[model samples]
Target: MAEYEALIIGLEMLVELGIQYVEILGDSMHVLKQIAGEYKCLSLSLAVYPVAARNLLTEFREATWEHIPREENFAANELAQVATSIQMPEDCVQRIIKIGKKSLPSILTTGMEIDVNSAAITEDDWRNPIMTYL
Candidate 1:
């Protein structure tokens, strides 16, 4: 479930960036296979993630998913661990941002829609939400 959530988040970021091509690499064969339609998502809790991922894939002109060894996926794994564990100092100048777990997929969230056809974004564009989230 964590893998799927990460995959969906990555895909959403790519879409917001207007990237037409993408190659996704992960260590989870089960998640990749389910996204590729080679395996069934039998768990009701996990079913929405693959569907959301597949829908995001359609936004790209070309997209591919590859499974790498766990050792090769160390960088992303380490990043995830750091993101979850890091604490901000109270006296720091920068404002502390908190992200809460979502009960629904990001696509179902409202107020941050990107225009896929519009290649250029102005300073006050709708991309503000994504930019802020990032």
Candidate 2:
């Protein structure tokens, strides 16, 4: 079973239907995470999938990515497996997207290599919380 083929095909249809951002949750961390933009997929061919996947993102004015646990993606993976086993046509699998939800802005932001908790937003900046009222 290929990875991008499913994601790209599904996303393409969504894009045509006016979908903006897309959140794909799954254990196929390899594909789901990368396409979600949570991680970089550095390959010339993969990157060239098409601007169509990107252009739709612009319609929303922004795009982002995140990774959710495998449990959340259970249904999709099951259906995908069925599709692959049957060698169903691409159009048939596209129907699975009907269950997809409108993409939301990823709440989990990417972390920095070094996340030192500076006094940037700490209470220690002041003697006491009440003192700030002064």
Predicted structure with the largest lDDT when compared to the true one = 1
Clashes of each: 0, 0
* 47 Cα displacement, candidate 1 (Å): 1.1
lDDT, candidate 1, at 113: 42
Score residue 42 of candidate 1 by CA lDDT.
Answer: 66
Window of ten residues with lowest summed lDDT in model 1: 110-119
**Residue-by-residue lDDT tens digits, candidate 2, 42-117:** 5534553323334334555345545556678677768869866764576674533334442322111212122223
Candidate 2 segments exceeding 4 Å error: 32-39, 50-52, 61-64, 69-72, 78-134
Residue 116 error, candidate 1, Å: 29
lDDT of 2: 0.49
Instruction: Score residue 28 of candidate 1 by CA lDDT.
Output: 93
Query: Which candidate should be chosen as best, given TM-score against the real structure?
Result: 1
